[model samples]
Each structure stands twice: as C-alpha cells, then as structure tokens.
Target: MGYIAPESPISDYDRDVVFFEGDLEELDFEVLQKGMELGFILEQRQTKTGDIEWVARDVRKFVAPPEKKVIPIPTSTKSKANPESPVNIYPSSYRTFLEKLSDSLKSIEKINDSGNFEDAVFSLLRLLGIHSVYQYSRDAQAGKADGFFILENLAVMYDCTLRNPFEEYKKDQIENYIHKLSNKSQLTIETRKADGGRGSKTLQIQGKSRQVWIITKGNTRELLVYDSIKVKEVAIKDLITITIEHCRELSYDAEHLSSKLVMLGD
Candidate 1:
C-alpha cells in the first residue's frame, strides 16, 4: 500500500493498476488540492485482503495572519511656558526632556514598541521618586509581569499594553500575572547608583496586600477578578499627569500616587 499526493490527477493513473470500487472517476481534483493545502486531505489505501481503507496523514501548514498597519496618532503639542517661573523645580534641560517624554508616552505609535514603552514607564516611575522600580526582561517567563515597583506600603505588579481595551488584556494572561504575584512573599531587587555602583536589598510584602495593575492607554477601570484577587486598571495618562505634577512639586510622592490608584480601584 502506498499514499498518493492530493495534487496527483486521477487521470494519470496506470491502466494496469485498478482502483478499488471505481472511485477514481468520482474524485474531484480541485477539492483534493484545496483540502491538501488546508491539511485536511485523507489518503486512500487498499489492503492485501482487497479491503479499502482511508488513513489521515500528519501534514499541517501554518499560515500566519497578515501584519497590521498601525497609523501614527498625532501627538499633542504643549505650549511653551516661562522657564523663569518659580514653580519650575527642575533644571531647564530636565524640564524640557520631561515634556518631550510626556508627549512620547501619549503617542500611540511610540508606545506600540513594548521595550521602549516599558523603559519610558520605568524612567517615569524613577522620576516620580519611587526608588524601588524593577523592570523585568521583555522575554520573561509565562507568569512574570512586565515590571514591579513599591509605593510606601503597597507593592504593585504591573503590565503595560498599548492595544485596544480588553483586547490584549485576556483573562488567562491576567491570571498568570496574578499567580506570579501571589508566589512572592518577599523580593530582593537591585538598585543602581549614579556612581556606577549596584546594591541589592529585600522588600517585605505584607501578606496579600499587593495589587496587579494594567497600565494602558485606554479607559481606566476595574478589569477582572479571579478568586479573591481583583485586577485593577490605570490609564497611562494618569501616570504622566502624576509625573508632571511631581516634577513641579515634590509632594506627589509614591504614597500619593498609591492613594490615587486605590481611589481609582474604588
């Protein structure tokens, strides 16, 4: 017994070889080719006992979906403010950089690159005076979240997505991140100093007093709940606003931002 290719025409059969039950004439070439392309073709065989048999072949072709064309969103332009204003707490150069960074984060096209977006968010968190920000690798394991940060007594595990609301925020993915968070009772994170020195320390998380936040460009609201764990949402715009406010006034610390997040959860 031998398998025949689906694309082989029935008319090209050897005259001496006989087909079982004269089924050759009933075979449709177009249907066979289409089925083969779709990996659904079945092979017909004849046993030594003159019995006809059909067997499925393990042949599958995976076709990737077409790439999506992302149209760049127009970034909002902020008017220039007086550099000599007393409220400007940062240097002129740093203030200009913060404004540009804010504009970049707001643009959909810029944040679409996950690596760049995560880096920007990490920088923003650091600028907001949250000293314990740890960014995970982009190719982190299944249950790992994008980044982790501490806010006073609160420990936040966050994932950033620039996609449409609820599109990339699948329930399974949220559950995975929650599982990662639940496993950690305490974490040791490394911090870098400007003098090119590195240091590590452990941060204790008080029982289940942790939060999983999805930072997105879309509307901020409660997204999902699994078991007793509630997954909350926060808009990136809110984070940018807090950063700007913190730049102008040092009082908008991580504790203040943490309170704002808790209020959003309510």
Candidate 2:
C-alpha cells in the first residue's frame, strides 16, 4: 500500500531504517498496527519540505531455511542368480576365496596389518572379473597410487586405508594422487605376479574417463571434499557387499561397480 520513496536519500536517514511514503490501505494499516503491538517500533518524521515520512524500525530478522537431511542408501542383500546365467558359474576355489576375504573384511578393525587389508581389496577386485588390475609396490616413489584398475573405458586410481576414523595423512595421500593425475598422462606401475610377473607397465590414462577413489575401513564423510575432483570414497562394508553380489551372480564387475560408486557419491 506504501512504497519506499526512490528520492529518499539513505544518507538522510539512520542505518537499518527504511523510509516509506503514500497512504496505508486498510489491510496495510492493520498489519502495521499489529507489528507495533508485537514490539515493532514505528516512527513518523517531517522532512524539510514538510513531507511526512514513516520510518519502520526493529523489523523481523531474516531466518535461513533448515538444511535438508541426506539419508544414505542402505546396502541390500545379495539376490539369487538365475541358474541359466552363464556368469553365475564360478570355480569352487574362487567361492572359497571370496568367503575368506569377506570374513576378513568384517573384522577389519582387528587386523593390525595394513598389507592384509590392501591385499584383500586387490584380490577382491580381481575376483570380481576385472582383469586389468595392478597393485603398486610399497617402495614406489612418493605420491604414487596404491593401485589402479581399468574398467572398460573408465580408469580408476585408488588407495586403501585401514584407519577406523580415517586419518589426515590418508586424505593428503589422495590429494597427492589427484595432483599426480593432473600432471601425468601415463602412470608407470608394477605388474602383479599373477599377471606373468612383468617388470612394470605404463598405463596411458590421458583422454580416458578417470576416477580417483579411497577404499577405506573408516568414516567417509571426510572425503566429501574430493567429490568435486571426481574422487570417490567407498566404505569397506560397501565393498564387501559389492563383492558378495558379484560372487553370487557376477552382477557387479569393475565398470558396474565404478558406476555404482559414482551414484553413491552423488
């Protein structure tokens, strides 16, 4: 019903106060009276030109809307695979190995050996049908990745952490890995003994769909910062679930798991 006068120079009034002109309609007058009754202070001032102005003070403060809660997707149980599905077939030894790995990961906190954790993760990936997986040597140069695997067109460089609460050094290691990725097109990594014991191999990663991930048995909320850099943090339990699903039906291979990781990050 009233307007903030354009010609009302702010310099002519006190800070946090707005000047309004024109007649207040019935509804507007009622609202103003109710506001004053609710402790809002209103003042009237006469300008040098005899113009009457209304100054409203002590207006309501702005309150921000509450943040939306993010509910994590619960991990699902493995479903029965079709007997006719060719992918459902696997060797007895492979099934035994999967069982053992899954058991070890369940009590990961009890395992003081980081090497065992890393090995279990690497073996699990291989068993999941990713043929191009390689584990990096512990003696490799600084800023080197712990391991990497190729999933069809996607290449993922990853590091493993056994810390339950997730330490800062692990995060620093991931940042270093990101920096390494940014600087190099090809990464030289040692070949695993299972892959013919080759001395070393150069992975050409430039122009490929690349992702950096931290496979940790720790809290993953800390890794949210890397989401913008295409980094994913997978909890140890989730990895075990993925492995179980794969072992059951050959459902989640490296490419499928990588895509699932992207979804989890989002």
What does each candidate score in C-alpha RMSD? 25.3, 24.2
Output the number of the lDDT-best candidate. 2
Q: What is the lDDT of candidate 2?
A: 0.60
State the lDDT of candidate 2 residue by residue for 79-145, as single tens digits: 3453332332333465588788678656654556778878878877776667788888665435666
Candidate 2 Cα outliers beyond 4 Å, as residue runs: 1-110, 140-143, 192-198, 219-228, 250-255
lDDT of 1: 0.59
Residue-wise C-alpha lDDT for candidate 1, range 1-266, written one tens digit per residue? 22344443333232222222223334443344423332333444557997544543443442444554443333343224633333323334656787886676566335678667766777777876677777764343344566778776677778776667564545677877677667567876454444546555577876645777877776667776665456888777777776667666422234466676556655
Provide the clash count, candidate 1: 0
Backbone collisions counted per model:
0, 0
| Model 1 CA lDDT for position 33 | 44
Candidate 1, superposed: residue stretches over 4 Å from native:
1-109, 139-143, 167-169, 188-202, 226-228, 250-254
TM-score of each: 0.52, 0.52
